[model samples]
Target: LDRLFARHEALRSVFVAPQAKPRVEILPPDAGLPVSEHDLRQRADTEAALSDLCHEEERTPFDLARGPLIRGRLVRMSDEEHVFLLTQHHIISDGWSMGVLVRELGSLYRAFVAGQDDPLPPLAVQYPDYAAWQRQWLSGERLQKQAQYWREALSGVPSMLALPTDRARPAQQSFAGASVPVVIDVDLTRDLKRRSRQHGTTLFMTVLAAWAAVLSRLSGQNDLVIGVPSANRGRREIEELIGFFVNTLALRVDLSGEPSVSELLERTRRTTLAAQEHQDLPFEQVVEIVRPPRALDHTPLFQVMLAWENHAGPSFDLPGLSVEAADGLDQVK
Candidate 1:
């Protein structure tokens, strides 16, 4: 825990706001992380007790300003069984960072258990340094060029998607949402990948093409815009650092002229390529440039979002510790 905290500056960062401009304040590393231990072996229903405990932990929100911003817990279910829970604020970490955290933790824990020196090399740069570089880099003609491209590309787009819903649209939008798991069998998954390759595009672009098609058919709107998150870690310097480097891109897909699947794929490919080129222009800046009409009920550019998570859970090969995914609310958390 000490090694991980010492290495990544973001782990000790807190956001300070209400100023002229908000900024992140990176604090010095603490002696150790805030961790709690619980033993539920004496309980009659250990599984249920553990589930409740995890749910409670997740619901407890973090204070961004006065924060370690991360917490950990160890639960003992039996003499041989245990579960380690680690939680962090979304501001401090992302999918890439999580992978780094787990991998580093495993490496550090292994060396500690064996009573050896830390094997990992020091980080080249921290998150704050990257932030400084970003502010300096994205300015002047470079920022304006990207901003102009987005304004022209998104001109005259429909204010909102006319998605048909079972219930009438509420005056004030509530973000109460639910997830329905759809199983795509292996054969279908394989075919999708194969088709993506044939189209000279990625799996994400292909899936995005399908989504745009579905939304167009349902909403009866030929022109559609959907938001997709990009890791924004193209630069080699910040790729390994833990920070909020993820950015959203408003992808506009035109389904006019009743194009076939192949034609749609081509359109999607082009749109993705263009977005990738101009992705450095932050989403907030893009909104300012486009000046899309805003409403209290909804967002300006895109309502629905698609996040392509190409990362899987980290592997923990520690002795006597079995790590597996939990079910239901635990999985959601």
Candidate 2:
């Protein structure tokens, strides 16, 4: 815990408001982070008790202005079974940051149990330093070049997609959504992987191509755009840092001419590569340049979002602990 606190400056960040533009104030390292413990072994229904505890924690929101944005707890279900829950605000962390945290925590725990020194090396640069460099670099000519590209690429594109929904469209849309799990059979998964390898593209691009086809068939719209989150961690210095380095890219995939699956995959691959070339341009700047027509009932540019989880938390083989990934909804809201 001490090492993690000292390593990542964003963990201690607090948002300072009341100014024209909000700024982050990184506080000094504290003694230790707050962690609660619960003993559910005494309860008659341990599974129900664990679920209630997690729901309570999820319902509790963090105060951005206050300190200790991250919270954790340890729940004991039995003498040999336990669960650890950690929560943090999205402003301070991201999917990649969570992977870093889990890997580092496992390393730190193993070292502490063995009574050894910390093995992690010093970071090349912190989050604040990256912010400073970004502000200085992304401006003037560079910003204008990327902005012009986006303007031309998204010219005359439809602002909203007509996805078929069961409920009627409301005056103002509500973000309340649900997740339905879709499982792909083993044969299909294997074939997708093989096709991706053969095409020299990623599985993500292939899946996205299929999704675009589905949307095209549903709405009868050949030209469409979908929003995707890019890791935007192009710099080697901030690759391992714990911060919000992700950016959204408006990927415009064309499915006209009744192209075959392979042809669509090729088209999607080219589109993704082109967008990735200019991904440094912030999404806000793109929105300003393109000036997509906004609607009160739906989002601008693209309503559907597709995210690819390229980073997975490291595996741990600690002495008495069985580590497994947790399942959750993948909605943006």
Which parts of model 2 are misplaced by more than 4 Å? 193-200, 326-333
What is the alpha-carbon lDDT of model 1 when measured against the actual structure? 0.85
Q: What is candidate 2's TM-score against the reference?
A: 0.91
Best candidate, TM-score: 1
Per-residue lDDT for 1-333 in model 2, tens only?
Answer: 667977899888889786667878887786456789999989999988887888898898888877678777788989987787878888888888877887787888888789998978888899999999998898899878888889988898897898888978887888888779899999999999999999877999999999999999999899999999998999889978998888999999999899988889999999999999999988988888899898789888898889888655456656557776455612111
Superposed by TM-score, candidate 1 places the C-alpha of residue 278 at a distance from the truth, in angstroms, of: 0.9
**What would the TM-scores of all predictions be?**
0.93, 0.91
Report how far off residue 221 is in candidate 2 (Å).
Answer: 0.7
